[model samples]
Target: MSTKPSLAVVERLYLADAMGAPLQARLRLSLCAGQGIVGDRHAGRRDWPGQNLTLVEAEEIENYCLSRSRPIDLALTRRNIVTRGVRLNSLVGRRFRIGDCLLYGIERCEPCRNLGQRLADETFDVPAVIHYWTGRGGLRADVLSDGAIRAGDKLEIVDTSGGLA
Candidate 1:
């Protein structure tokens, strides 16, 4: 983590109602711990944590757009939350909170090459896409507490000690 991670704000929120459906931007999301976001397509599919929530850095998205020299929508990243002012990768294995929801960062949300092909333009190719989103994709987290989170809500690191029982 070269960049010092700090408090972040949820810059954008999105949800997909069904498989392969387009991401719909939302002002707020009702999250169910261990069940995922209410009404979201992937909500009840997982019987575990890790994937209950997904977040991507707005800054990284900006960097990718700059590298590709084209404006890409945040929704296309397919992450549940878009955070500003934090290095999300640094949060892996740490406990954080957005609104009243507590979450454990399980792993890095790696880039998808298929989405890369779609994002790639004439000048930039798939290789460039991989190069850009390799480590900057986002985060996959396990929700620890059920709560509602809004787009403008603050994301704070509540525990970095790995949540000792």
Candidate 2:
């Protein structure tokens, strides 16, 4: 099986620096950069630097995207960065090249209890047990390039650092 990152598209987009914030309910998932993608929805936080993933957990995001009905152009979060066509979890312990930027994948983004609360559906248990999630879903990447990322930009995995076995 080929182990490459994939993308999943959503009919709607949601953004917010904080839970229950106006930014949460008002954001749209349309194809837009700067205002939506590649920037920080939660820039000021010392914990989360860029936009984060919401629906798909880190290890499972790519798989979820692959099985999705339509091709998702990008996945944007409350964090500062936007990812396109790249599965964040698959890049764990690997380095991704986006233009002049090179980001190192740290770990899988497990889902949080907050997700269950936010979703109000509590369907995370099934995926979590399958190793698709750990509880909170998302990823953590250190910024290599300080520029804006859009939907069409290419995401290349340069090195796996003994990863992707």
Which prediction has the highest TM-score against the true structure?
A: 1
TM-score for each model: 0.87, 0.51
lDDT of 2 at 96: 66
Report clashes for each candidate as comma-separated counts: 0, 17
lDDT of 1 at 67: 64
lDDT by candidate, in order shown: 0.84, 0.43
Q: How far in Å is the alpha carbon of 29 misplaced in model 2?
A: 13
Shift of residue 88 alpha carbon in model 1, Å: 0.6
Q: Model 2: residues >4 Å from true position, as ranges?
A: 1-19, 22-41, 48-87, 122-132
Give one digit per residue, the lDDT tens place, for model 1 in 1-165.
Answer: 497656689999999998778899999999988878999988866754566788999988887776666676787688999999878888888989999899889888887787688778787788887777888889889878899999899988887665322
When summed lDDT is taken over every stretch of 10 residues in candidate 1, the lowest stretch is 156-165
